[model samples]
Target: MRIERLWIPEKPSVGKDIVQALIRTKRAKVLNAKSAATDGYFSLDTGDVVCPLFGHMLTMLPPAAYLTKEQNAGNYFEFLPLIPQPFKFEPKPDVDAKGKAHPPKRFNLIGELSKRAGQIVNACDIDREGQLIFDEMFLYWGLDPAGNRFLRAKITSKAETDLDRSVTALEKNGAEHWVRQRMAANARQVMDWLLGMNGSMAYQQLTGIKTMSVGRVQSPVLAMVVLRDLAIQTFKPQTYFVPVVTLADGTALRWEKRKDAAGTAGFDAAGRLIDKSLASGMVGAIKAGARGTVAVASTKVERESPPLPFSMGRLQATASKQHGLSVEQVTKAAQNLYEKHKAITYVGTDCEYLPSAMHADAGAVVAQLASVFPGKCAKADPGRKSRAFNDEKVDEHFAIIPTGLVPALSDAEYAERAVYETVVVRYLAQFYPAYEYEKTSLVVMYGPDEFRASARRDLVLGWRELEKPESTETEEAPANGPSRPLPKLEVGQQLAATGVSLETGQTKPPSRYDEASLMEDMISAYKFAKTERDRELLQETQGIGTSRTRGPILQNLLKRGFLLSTKKGKRHEITSTPFGKETIGRLPPWLTDVATTAKWELMLSAIALGEAEMQSVIESQIQYVKTVIERARMQVSPRQSAANEKGAGAAKKAA
Candidate 1:
């Protein structure tokens, strides 16, 4: 008999859970008693089959796949550019020691099952990439997506409850929403391939280099580090002075000249006091025992809400910053938490907001988390929903949060423990009340200048009681020193200066980019946009690359020898290598322009939203690839010139 239903998930692990969930719910009975959970698909007595597809079983064909034998043998420069009218794809092949190619067994299995199943359900991830993964397989197997037999099961989490909900709420596979998203994802994959293949080949052919790698996002990311390194290398410092007075009560106050027509300015435009004589005079005037009056005093109460739960990028950045973990380490740990333990939601999501509906599940999730982190989850109030519970901001997946499944882990797994606790504590903070504090601002009138001071006092230890801020973070103190708590005083209260001094300092260059800072910058690349339109577009799109690709982009650069990562204490400082800088210098401006790539991202987003046509975007990228190839052909290789010079010198020496 034809199978009643066939479910295809993104991987074997997800398929195993789906089978278990169906069995536990009594929705289906297992048919194969001897098959291990990890090895084979689950056949059910109800004629339903559960199978899984390895991530991206198929990929775009290489240039050789399109070019004729003669054209392939010709110089890469002569062919100029290879733009396949309609790109073709095939299953990624594996070669054995005997050099025979074999298609992945999983890929063949899916093809075989699609013939027998009456309906094929795409139970892959809920994102664009996931759509593309399933769609590609469907196309390769000659299965029609628009047919009524195909469906989409949007699973957000692997938890049994979520899986059942998703299965029961399946939608048509060829709906406009799914089509548009798949189209957009396909555009990104093809464009990246076009640029990487043609652009890199052009450079290699012209420069006589054996290997060169470039991409739409990778090149621009390399430029960010190279340009930052250049700025630091070329920066010039200017010396300045900062004057401050210490009151008898040990409060430090910074000196500021009054902004009046009759008063002379004592500081530079950058807020540095460059007038050495003025600084010295102020120190002499406000000597020990000199008196001053409080010209102004005020205190205001402020409330700081708890931080939102971790988005994947935010979690990676925080883990890198706090625990000195690499992006790969944190990402791997997070994947294990989601896939192996089923303890967290999707880990590739960039959104930090949760569905309002999920707010009701907070109590159950917290109860489960309490089993592992009893003390940390003690005071959480699941009833209170913070701003993070806004439904409008949620997309394919919600922020990373506990799935109410207790993770089976030991203390020895430091990386996994660190990642899980970081996510759990962040989730718990949402249930706590806002932190409240009273900030006091004071201004004292000295002989010819004004001194300012501020201090903060805790009024309500709410969320802060759960987790204290990282000690590495601190406020910038005044030139004299840290400010002390202020006593209650009237505006006319008098104070004596117990000491005064001026400190000499110089301007410092911007700090180098580390993994954490670079990741943050990648997410906020809109700030570097050159045009208002591009900035607005980048804002809507949220960055050049998706959350899943940014970390790999950085790692790929390091692997390709384009960037260097050096250990500075616990942090790895990133710097561009000489070859990296040379690559950027030789590339056209548009290639390294972050704004341009952001604009591309905006285009892709439009395609995904059904606002733009995919063909138009792909055509534009084809033109861009052609232009890059032509430009590369026009340039002479420095290596070629050096080789010529060496040959001439050798000839002269022989004569």
Candidate 2:
């Protein structure tokens, strides 16, 4: 069953490894020098050709070079957007002012291969981004599938078994619907280009700044920082006192009040009383072992739902919160699992649910894990219909999970293994029994005051056997560790306090966002939208950026001085600088609004889903670009500039 040619990833190391696996799976033979060939590489026995491509050999043209002379003269772009019919693209090599390309030789090589191959296999990774990468090469060569036969070999992992399975399951696509993905990717790239190319030039010229970089996604992020820091600056600290009483067992209770007068900052979100005098007087009346009555006690057993599998955002948050790994670090770890170890599915997806159709494959994968995690494995019900495998929630690819190719962890890097294990535990947890716990509560009455104490005991470890929770905040921890199980309790029983104290504290400013929380905010950014309809638009659009690009955007913001990070102990605190704030202050709502970009992004997504035509989305953006140009042209008045100059002149005379 040997094919005439086999195409795979372009990296020599990866290509060589994949070729070896294909040889085993199909007994394919190599005909070339086995040396990487530019145009003539072939499979010897069957006359098949194997080729790999680095992604997107051709890209949208850059600003100065992209526009024609008349357009560059600021005539066309100033009034109208440059809408290339079919949207032109060129090789993304270093370009001179005249648009000359100095591309890597491989770009031309792929173009040549596109012309020769009769049966061109789209053996790219199984994601829209991957489809765009390989499809763009053929598109740039003007080689339509109408003339050449096309096949798609899509798989989420480089693992041998998954790769072999994909080889057999290849789909024939003479219609080139796979290239529809290229439409979505290109629309996004062009959308960014339109915003950046026009917005940056307009801003730099208007503000008299030598250089300014603005973006559809980047500008909104800048505003997030600016608004947060402004709130921090203007926030007034409120003073409050919390009543604390120590019990006979050295356990302390913080007085909890559900409600108070509306004007009182009563019991902050963490439930601390706002009345200082009342708290102080209550504390004064109490001694170390003050007698009180336990008015009521209750206990119940409940089962907690298993966690959904890891999406990039959840994984980033988990790693950051549990292990102090930065979002960048966690991303690299996930990449390692996909690329080097080949232990997991694709890592760049935002979807956290599996396709229901993959139940058999998931079951097979879990069966392989029995030896590795025997205790938890015994509890797994891989074939069960659960929340993790819901087709309605799936898009492009399923959640990141083990691909059944277990790696030797003894030789793996610590960070890589940590991320891999995190994914594995999360994946397995979905199939295991639900975690059951007994929660008990007791309330003590002191005159009119009441204090509640609660304790929880694991009745059944269940999925918790593999997925243990990490405590980050005090509120997240068991009521003061409840270090001991609650002693047998009875209603109306007398209880005593050993000591009492009044602790006065000031409300702290909202802390700067770290990567994990930032990722959460970016995903849930619809919460920041100005209107209900805009919020729904953002929610449907998956917020401001894709999983693959958001982290890099934040890193770029830090590099460009739009945001600053300071290490406080193990965790970093991030905030915006003065320049970042000023930039946001001067920008118009269209540029800085998250909902604005989200509205446009939703249209791009609709284009991808084929719900809306690409032309309409492009036309809408064109109108937005016109507004940007107008804003850039309308600068502050000359009289205001001259008045400032005159004031400076007067100040100098006085000096």
Candidate 3:
């Protein structure tokens, strides 16, 4: 006899809703139902009923009676009734000469399932969520975990054709790493639930605020933004002067100004220049000279390595600057390309290359990409740098790349496709060779003034040929010769200068943060922070949020009015708002500090890698949370209570 197999579709949220609906509609009917016992079977007698074996069992058992004695003792185990208890397994007994054992043969669900065990295969999506879904189903069915064979399918698109191919591939080999990743992913979810539920409830009760929520990452990130705003608000600008001189030939030269003849801007208590005034006399003396001899003039070759492939954040920032698309818009397009078109790999990866196993099929990607990236595609080079092949970096999935699927997209989709294609082409270029260039700088001096000019002659365009021209200024110059060659000169050589004039300008504060600069700041927050320890840890962990979460957090900050965009022509300037300042000022010192979050991230990373204990990290985090709750309670209590009272009065009057 063949083993009987049972499969359940797992959709947790939807399943819970359905169960609740069923209970509400059939509670009375189920209570009134009768059970009939036959020779070898038990039957539920209902006029109208449709359910699987497990559902029928659930209907038969009283909710309260289903719980164990310990679970029924308190409300803490409210969820216990929902826990699934699957049918048991039993082996077949040998038939007697009379053709029956003492219990007799029975046709039942459990007996059927036991016989069918060998034929079972768990077919789940190859991801963490899918693994969890299958795991839950297996546990509920009382199936032997070790005896089960698992098969995973990758569904990158909603189209039937794509799904068919995924199913076929899954039938060939199971995704084992995806199963392990699912375990880690589920662990993270449980940790978040525990922290968020308990922490939010506790903090809300302490602070008297309704619906106040906290999470493993969100609260800490919010605190970081508030802290940054505070720093900006308290920032004071200092005065500094730069002196510009006009030569006899009308050329202007700016000299590095100092406070005194000893080139000191300001001196310490040990008799060094400590103020700008000391450089004032030197500026005056230089101004009187009216001319100077060219002291030095030299230039050398410089090369810039190609940038790594686009992570989601990099792609968004690039699109925002180049195409005027918002980060949200670009992210949506990228997600579509990954999920709907199946044209790209995962979007949030920081790595630029696929794993070694993927290298054998690199030619397929290049061949499929031949049309869009004509000159960019080439056979994979075996001698490529180790940075492009390390397995340790290829977590979950490799970097975003072409999926070897020729894209058929609409006009709007084509625009997004171009942006994605640019990233892929650049990534492929890394396996090629470095671009070379000759840079020249001409330093000229007339009277006491000196001026410098620079020009670059590209020896080879290399990967830069793929980049689109943004403006006439960036148009490729004729590669034939140097546009502005300087005459050879000795140290004392004098030269005539043109365009001489005195230019007056006030000292400006640091520029407001733009998207790219903000990204860089977030990437290197510790280095920019006031303390060395803060910088070290931040650098170690790489920044506040992961690639997956940074763009969303920034968007939230902007939407909440903490950060505002100032548009000047095509450029955007991000400045902190007045409300942002107030919020920062009201936040507790520890909560708002970026260092706090940075340290937390460092500790969390260490824990994930088994270098630190999870319990120790949790203990430190709990203490931090307690401190935050106390500070927020003291600071927000009066204001929040007054607001709540006003709301209650309004509600009462309305009623």
Candidate 4:
């Protein structure tokens, strides 16, 4: 039987060493090596009577030439030239059937090999996209689909040991789930194409906007940003009075802030603070000599589970909040660590927890990471298992862990090493014990006014040791610092008013969104969705976008002027631009709300799992699109309406 290998030049440059090792293990000899161009098709003959074919390069057509007139006359709907044009894939004559036919132009090796080979083995990277590439080649060859075989091979590092293991696995058996995953991946691509090509073109024609890009993901993401901006714009600030009283111990305490039965902040119909006079009167009475008594004193042993390991989004949020790194910067650094340094698995994942099986390897990964981050890694305990190691919480991939490739040299490298070290340390922390603490709550009442003080004593540092050094930098005295030791007291114990005063403060408006806070809000928005069914749906679907794509989605919104960032030192506050506000105002109300996308994602997930029908989803989406189009047409165009133009200008000024 003959065998063939198809390759792309770009792949070899990045992956040749691993490919060579695979071929060597197969005991295949190189019969010939050929290329169309230096950077084009670089194929190797496996000399086992196999034909070789070029990958992606073979299918690429030369750039089509268009005259100025033709370019101007081209339909506005024809936005993406890369998309298959009408009648482009129609069959063409090639010679006769008995080896008289001309060689296939695209991935010709597939056809050549199929003629002699009894079976075909697909050896591609064990990823969804990789599987798609192999499948495309298989179909292109017109070979018997049933005759094709699938092999899963992974190159963990450049080390021969890792390569050998991969080859051994390939020779034994391949993973079937990967094939199903590939089918899902292909479906996603097809769905995106259909939605983007049709919806985007239709929207663009109606809006008469050049280069209006939209997609299943991108459109919803854009709408989210626009909606957030509108929320900020439409927000009306109101004054709320809080009673602040100085206790006997000179400790100032603020009121516990009342909430409605539904747990909403107590406010009037117009969202103004309710019972303003009652709060002010309480503060005055407390200041006017009222002996304070210990109303309640309760201490509880609270064990805080160690934080889950670092997913890309979690890591990015942490880095943004703690290290002041931008989401883009953190993601780029992580990609380098994963792809170039080979120090970590896939950079983006939703799972912040690891399975018990991964715990055994945590020590080795921590040891490797310790070389770069001695301070943080030194505090990590390897043997213990914390809540972060819950296997039940892990999905798709485990928490980001090092691939055991020790990085060396350079200042930039050290910076990336620090980031990777953070990820590794967090990963290791999952196996460490939970941080145990004693939380004490003391409430002192002076007349009708109640003042509260809380203190926490760390009984066991556990995983918290990794954070101690950083926390130390921000530590301060009593009220601002670590909690003070409280004197023994029983309920109703009389306390002398050592100090009494009133502290007046103005109510602050809601803060603008930051990257980390935005991520939290996005997650919270889905979690707190109304209706049990909607909540359950969101719980199952998680959120509108995966952790892998959320950062990029946010970045795209910012790039598209839907979100604007205001920098204040290391902090970035996200706000909406006038264009963003206009977009939100013009968009259908349901489309602009995140809940809609959340629901759609839930349905899509259901469809993927075969719990929901694809036809139903398609029908719903079609109706949604129709409604959006109708609403958009009825609304005064944002660009054309003088009122909207003025409103946008005003919003910009306000921003």
Candidate 5:
């Protein structure tokens, strides 16, 4: 029963894979193979056991667990804020059909194993959440998390080579890096718990909204939706006009203002004239046989580098735009490709760069991809290093790439195929040359007015040829102009106007935040920051939530009826419900301001980086929660205030 070393991966399947890899590398042998799945452990010949955690084995204890006896018997508002000194934790429980709660089945097994093992290795995922998982588990099982017996196996993937190397190089559990991660995760969890518990209760007490729930991230996300919906509801369009002259070749050139007349004709910032008379006069004169002389301003070659590989957020946004897939759908498909098919590397990573050492392996992977995508992979020079291969840019995991596993997927797997093919194409795109094009900028003079036109001509379809979707034969042209090459013209060639007309258009309102755009905003939240420091912090933290948690946060809003989503063609148009609007209006500014949340997020990240103390951050949040709750309690409705006074009197009598 005395196991020398215990290995704990994040999932059961991962544990099995790690065990098999150890055996394949002749580093470990099965002592009891049957016990692997039946129980949660696989005893090894090297006197180590491989057992896995089911995501998180422990969760923060609810605030009710720390309520005083008097507070339980009386008005709960009296216990305005419940701050756990050390933050007690309990095993995340499971409920049966009969509604009886019990610890997870493997909880006892892991707990017993922890007690008997000489050394326990935290072989979880290599992320903050993973470290928190092991930290909470050890604390719940009454073991010292910082003890010398505890070690760490920083595993990023389930591949045999990665697992072998990770297991071979076990790190000290109490190392500063690992400890700081634990501290950061702990602070984040504690902050969320405090906010949800205290803020929700305070909101309920003040507004009597029984269905309301507040969170650190979700409230601000809800505020964003509500504000956008209001903006769209209240938006008023202003009409503008422009004189467009049509040439014999059907190229319509819009009138451009000269430097002296830039702001003379009631022109807007975008140079659209609000004066209908001026536009009409220009059109009338141009249509009356006005001859224009061509003034070729510039003609030059322009090269656009290929897009870098996909991060999860980038992949989600692209999939939503190109394939009409939601972020949730793309996430699921990507996860399937990573976990089920083993076709790609880790899917939960935010990093989009690979280690420089991975170039040789990537070349081999590209060679394998040629079998499946011959045309796309034909010119893929994987040996040529792209900007994505910098080692310094890599985070906990590298950008997702094919593991060289050509999966034989069925046609029914639409999402999977979409995700896999996109990833494959994007990865190969970096290996090809930049897309080169000839851009011609022209200015035509008609009497006293000037018109501008531009055209793009393809010079070399380097990566663009390979980047096109399989379903499309031709590339989609840009919106403003045609993709055709412009006709050759001299600087002073005279051209007769075929026709001229005034085009009237109205300004459009901002689009609604669908799941894709919302996710994009969440990643680029620095734009909404109130202060420059918050903006910088948001940029570093990649907006509000991590890629792994953003999808769920959005889904939770839908589940809670805070935001209503409607299917408009292929995309979902998201709008805030009236109740959601009311909830946000009643919530404090700090809870709804993204800049405030971004500051806290940065502090949490700093804790993980060992730049800030965890206890100080947690202490600050505790005081913040207390003040927020007190403010809410004071801002209660008159009726609710009377009811609260009545309840307090009743409680005092009982006490």
Candidate 6:
């Protein structure tokens, strides 16, 4: 009898491991899913030749025209982007150490196996790139699309249980319309490739630099930092005085100046307090033991819901803040936890909610963890519906969480353990009760000025047993400083103003972007948009780069010397280099704007969803590039010349 096969996309040995894991969990019978490594290469006998494709079996290549242009351009490779495109793909190389081109063994093996197998079931990772990786090979290997079936494996973790579950729940006959995903990935890859190369060329041509590395996502991020730095550089510090009064109860409050006070006919646009004299006069009056009655004081109990579970972007930011790890570092640790430790589920997801189908299993995992941790989930009700398990929120992948496989990490790195613990705690805290607290605000009358005092009192430990708001998180009222529990105060209570003061301070420029803040900014870039539609598009798309791509993009930027990194205590501060600033300055707004890039990403998504055609998006993208270059050439040439002339004049003057 002919045996059936369930081929997957792991390396040869790794494929064997998957089969073994399946067998261990009794998800697959040991006799049927035996390992076969007789030829020094491994495969699984899962009633068939279940094998691994390693990674990508074929490599995507630029068009022949672009290749010719790139080869001939030599040192001036930047101009190669100016060429038109008809992207090409060729089989990736695979050979032993004898300097022999043995051809791709996996590709050939797949071809050989496809002939015997009735259906080609794609058991690769459930992602666009993963779809492309396997589909490209199958198509190239001459497998018919009708016969080729896709079974997307949603492997949350590499644990035996997860793989068993993922393989068991594998949707037959490509239920997700996964081929469209391949189309989307192809469009994205080609689009980014074209944009980066072309954008870099335009920058090099405009700035007279031989080389630059600008991209759809990268240039905008660089612009964000550089523009911020420019804002800091050009900002003229304005001296302002805030009149503050302290009560006899040691309650300090700032005097409210709704409109400008007397001696100021009009307010200064830059400075809040145009008349320091008025503030001085008020301070003198208060120092003479000014007595005032409480104006409006209020207290209310507030319930702060537990934070949404960790999306990849959120996880990256949290890890960067909590452990002082770089985004790339956090991403690597996360990948390891999912792939190696089998502790956490799909780490690349942007979603904070689990799929409705997985809620039962996820709740079971939580219950198991609760038993292990003891008392942490005391208030947690697994049966209770929560925000963590929302069907609408789950997209291609679910949130990162423990897969009920408690990782038996023997000697993991401190940072790795820290990241894993972070994910675990985040998941644990999701089940706990909402953190309850009481907030009190007191407003007192000191002449015409109203002084405000606010305090936060903890009402319940709640979910805070597992998670607490970061100390570094921005407060609603930073000027008031930290919060403390307040004593009882009535609205009509009389209070003595012990002293008054005028605090002199200069306005601060926006803080520099650290990995944490930068990640947040990148994720929330849509919030900065001028319009609602732009914001909506961005929110849906999750801003520029995807969860898997941002870390690598940042790494590429740092590697290419476009940005400089400096360590400030625990945080790594990212600053734009002179070249970076120049690149952003030289690019047109359409190219440098994050919203514009986000639109392109969003368009690709629309294509994937059948809302838009792929060819139309690509054509529009090509036209957009041409337009950007045409417009930028005009703006950049004059500026570059002016800068050069200015530099020459300065040299002459020095001489």
Highest-TM-score candidate: 5
lDDT of 4 by residue, 1-655 (tens): 3444332211433345445555777755443444434323333455333223333322322113222333233432333222343211212224576757564443444455446553344444444445555665555555423333434444333434445565455421134454444454444454455455555544454455545555676665566556555566678655555555555454555554333412234544533344567555665665566667888888878776666667666777776766666777778887777656667776546666676776777687668767767876766767876766677876445667676677664775644756776776666666556778777677777664556666677798887776543343244223413466555569988765554444444444456678766765555446546677777667655466666567877888888887787776666678777766665454445554667666766665565455666656665665665555455445445454554445445655555
lDDT (Cα) of model 4: 0.56
Query: Each prediction's TM-score against the native?
Result: 0.86, 0.79, 0.60, 0.74, 0.88, 0.83
Candidate 3 C-alpha error for residue 302, in Å: 2.0
Sort the candidates on TM-score, descending order: 5, 1, 6, 2, 4, 3
Per-residue lDDT of candidate 3, residues 1-655 (tens digit)? 3322222222222222222333444331332224311222111122211112221111122333455454333222123113224312232344689987544233244345444444333333334444455454444556533343444444433233443454345432234454444444444444444445544544444444434555565555554545555566666644444444444533334543222334433533223333556346535555455445776656667765555666665666666666555566667777777655657765655445557766665665667677776666743342554245557665544566667775687785755666676556656765555567777654555432334544567786655665542344354342223554444456677654333333333333345566655664555558546677666657665565556666787777778776676665544556666655554444445545555555665665564444666556655655655554455445545666576456545655555
On lDDT, the leading prediction is 1
User: What TM-score would you give candidate 4 relative to the actual structure?
Assistant: 0.74
- In the range 16-110, model 1's lDDT, one tens digit per residue, is 87788777665678887578455457788877799888788898888888876655544576676888878888888767899998877777777
**Clash counts for all predictions:** 0, 12, 21, 4, 0, 1
507: Cα error in model 2, Å: 1.8
Candidates' lDDT values, in order?
Answer: 0.82, 0.71, 0.49, 0.56, 0.80, 0.70
Inter-residue clash pairs, candidate 4: 3-50, 6-53, 384-431, 476-481
Error of 2 at 442 (Å): 7.3
Residue-level lDDT tens digits of model 5 in 552-633: 9988999888888777777867889888899998887777887678778889888988899998998899898998888887
- Model 2 lDDT per residue over 263-335, tens place: 5444555556687766776777776345678876888897877788988777877776566677788888888
